[model samples]
Target: MLYPTLRPIRGATLLLTAGLLAACALPRVGPNKSEIFAGSVLREGDAFVLTVDDRVNAIAAVAPALGFSAGFLNAGELGADTIRAGDTLGLTIFENVDDGLLVPTGANATAIEEVQVDAQGFIFVPYAGRVRAEGNSPEALRRVITERLAEQTPDPQVAINRLAGDGATVSVQGAVTAQGVYPIERPTRSLIPMLAAAGGVAVEPDIARVTIQRGDQRAEVFYDDLFASAANDIALRDGDAIVVKSDSRTFTALGATGAQDRITFESRTISAIEALAQVGGLSSTAADPTGVFVFRNEPEEIAEQLVGQDVTGPQRVVYVLDLTRPNGMFMARDFAIRDGDTVYVTEAPFVQFNKTIAALTGSLSAANGVQDATGL
Candidate 1:
């Protein structure tokens, strides 16, 4: 009679323990709506929680625009024929007198095959001394040399011929069909043409980014924009270094997404709906459609616009989308997903409840098996 009484009591105790454990620690993809909202202003949490709406969507859409800056857009034209340092010039000094300087006896003209411009922008002739070669065309440089040689020689005539130059070249590297140093000539004087000289970009045009670094100034623009507007085709300067690369902007898909991974942007800008579709959308069996969230550290300016107040540095923001609502789909369709964001979808409430009931039932079944084994 004692054994019979103890058996039912033991099973009842096991069932109660399992129920308590399941309620306390049910596995979840992430925080539920109540838990996330607990940290809102109404609660003690510091993160700015916002429900997705048209006004919030518009405010958050003001992302950092990726395009050429003023320094790049307002660039002046670069003279294709202008000489620069390290250029190779051919100088021919013609003197009327047979025994004149810079020319062999009986030879009226002296040809100097290669006259390299020094780093200081000066070139040295036999009698003309040092003259500035950079920033002058071949004809302009010839006039300067003639004046210098006229002092000692009678009726001195000078001619300058520009040869193949290595000074006025731009280096193209990164994701391109060809990577090398190319001369800035008639066809390759501007940004777009220079990129074409490298056999165009190796990556997709929609996602390619082209950056131009000239001395201390730097600017970047999308490759597709170069053709979209002619103003974006800024002139290329000497010593300009161009890099063509695939856009590195990415967002992470976590929690109940069909695929949880960091995905690259397929376009220059990605909306919330587009980002979800890229990751195979939410899991049908586990995802809570109402708990879609975007986690980001918004810049101070954008944060102020969203909250309608001043905020310092970057502020923690969590944007929520409830698909159960009528306007939820439209809000998600318009909301922009910025770089370095985490797109998380929480599991449905019923899913966790199901797990708890399963846990409790399993515990009770094990207790019944024990009773049967003991023949009680």
Candidate 2:
């Protein structure tokens, strides 16, 4: 009976000790600071880890330019008076003498409204025959008609007025107040005006993006950028397809954060501090203020600038942000968090120690109870 009692106590002690040993391997949201740094290139790790300094901040602050190219910026504004195919024209012909070719007898003047231009860009008049109207101004078309009718009637007077055409139009759709095909008129000749004509964008201006596709050319810009710079208010073209939509850019927040999820970019550009704030900031009790990290895939050119080494294509990069330093918060504020980035905060070192101690103490207490029960 004594041997059996001692054996039970020994068994209980072994079980408690094993439970304490296993406490170091507790489940965690992600790898800790030491594990992350150990994997960096400096420590024979897979990624390049760099501290966020002024130079690094400036280098990482680079964002993709969002605006039209030379083609869109350099394009001349469309002439509102110019007539295109499928447009409607109003024509009036007058002759001083009676029995004029175009004007009926005793009428003196003949007015024809809604004279639609055919697909071939031609408009037909009774005696004037077919006349090319596309690419011609209203005044120019009037001159062409007056000269043609003069052959049949002496000093024929012609007046031509241009109307909204089916051609030279753009299709506006997606996230606009109104989505429809709108003619490029005097008031809606450019990007911003056309958007206004569509009742403006339906989404927030900070996250709105406008993309214009004309044949083979395509360009995109932030909705706010259209007002920030005049050059972004690009000229509209015939058959142009304009789409306004909310930005699709997002980043993942994980590890000791107040919230762990994918967060959208509220603005065209979001700094690290802003991103942290968006996710409800870091966990007050569990987060290591010195272990905030941003993981990203840097382009070769940017990676070279960041690491002072020659790298090609996409490079795995980890940017360390220490909030304990005096400039740490400013560094975080200045650091740019890009799309598809992962923001992770490691746990405080004492958190693991506490977890281990708690596990050991709980197991020891359970073992003592087991020993007492088996003391028969």
Candidate 3:
């Protein structure tokens, strides 16, 4: 009876060992080659080494808008300039005191208060009646008010001034210190200030997934770009809703790695080397110099686009990087990591024996249990 049991156990052990070896030899499916390469290396003209010069050039390349060529030159780059419906504008009119000879002091006489601008850009002024202030400059609105007042008083002096009015309001929801509606003064309002106003982002805000919605257009703003490249920090407009989501998913690096479980960087631009360092670097015992694998999701459409081309799939293209090679280190820097990239460092072949032994011990335990039950 012992001989028969030993033969069967030996066969089972051999089969398990073969299965484990086959599993170990299987290749990992990584990110799409196109997407990885596109992000890994900077464009020919673009700067790979992020520096002040790169920032300056990036700013210069931005298109001019609203009489401003770039963010560096824009002084009135605030939200107040872009007026929208429901925004309150303050208007102040003063009577010509001292026969218009002297500058009228605040004490002379006047009325000042906040007034709401209607959707049609109409602001109801006291005594002066409704005035269309939208699309008009501050001076233009003042002149319009003075002209309207001429109908009521002869030689009636009018002073048109923009009083503080309601500014455009936007809602910021998700992974922020505070999530609520923020009032923006104009369309050119910088997003940084708004995020600051909302109490900044949470400790682990989903930086890669920041979404900005305005009307029908939606833009994804990654944290790394927002912080690293000033050009990517977009201006906010009225009625814009910014949502900062929290990252619930995490990447697991197992098998003789420095850290078994590590949270992925919220920024989409992190490199493969940076990711490895984040988990306390590679394990000396199990890290194979040529067996580093980065597993990531690949969309079918993006994969198909790379099939015929020189590029690999945009979603899943396993990059076999040799740490021993100096060129490979540079390539690691070029490989831009995506949102859910999993960096796995396979153990040396000897590690497989440890796993196999553990499995055999469990099998023997089960066998003993069966023998005891049968009173063998």
Among these predicted structures, which one has the highest TM-score?
1
Estimate, for each residue in 1-376, the C-alpha lDDT of model 1 and write its tens digit: 6665665656475757676775688677778888888877558788899998999998988877778878778878666677898889998889999788888997889899888999999999887789998877787888889988889988898888887685478899999999999977778889888888899999999999989888988888889889889999998888899999999999999988889999989998889999999999989998999999999999998889889888889988999998889989889999999889999999988898888778777767776787678776
C-alpha-based local distance difference test score of model 1: 0.86
Estimated TM-score for each candidate: 0.92, 0.86, 0.52
Top candidate on lDDT is: 2
Q: lDDT per residue, candidate 3, 1-376, as tens digits?
A: 6655554554465566557655664332232223344543343321121211223223322221112124322324443554555556655554544433222554444554566678898887665688886655556667777677666544445444445544556788887888988766543267777888888778554343467776876666454446656655666655778887754445656544677776755453466677787787777765665566665544544334333334343444444555667566766666655556567666665555665666657666666676567665
Provide the RMSD of all predictions against the true structure, rounded to 1 decimal.
Answer: 2.2, 3.0, 10.7
Q: Report lDDT (Cα) of residue 74, candidate 1.
A: 87
What TM-score does model 3 achieve against the real structure? 0.52
Number of clashes in every candidate structure?
0, 2, 23
* Top-down lDDT ranking: 2, 1, 3
For model 2, name the residue pairs that clash.
39-45, 40-45
Model 2 Cα lDDT, one tens digit per residue, 1-376:
5575466565568665766677557767789999999989888877999999999999988877878889999987776766788899889888989777767777989899999998999999988899998877788889999888888779989988765565478999999989999877788889999999999999999999999998999999888889988878888887899999999999999988889999998887898889989998989989999999999999889999999988778899999999999999999999999989999999999888887777777777777777678773
Query: CA lDDT of 238 in candidate 2?
Result: 77
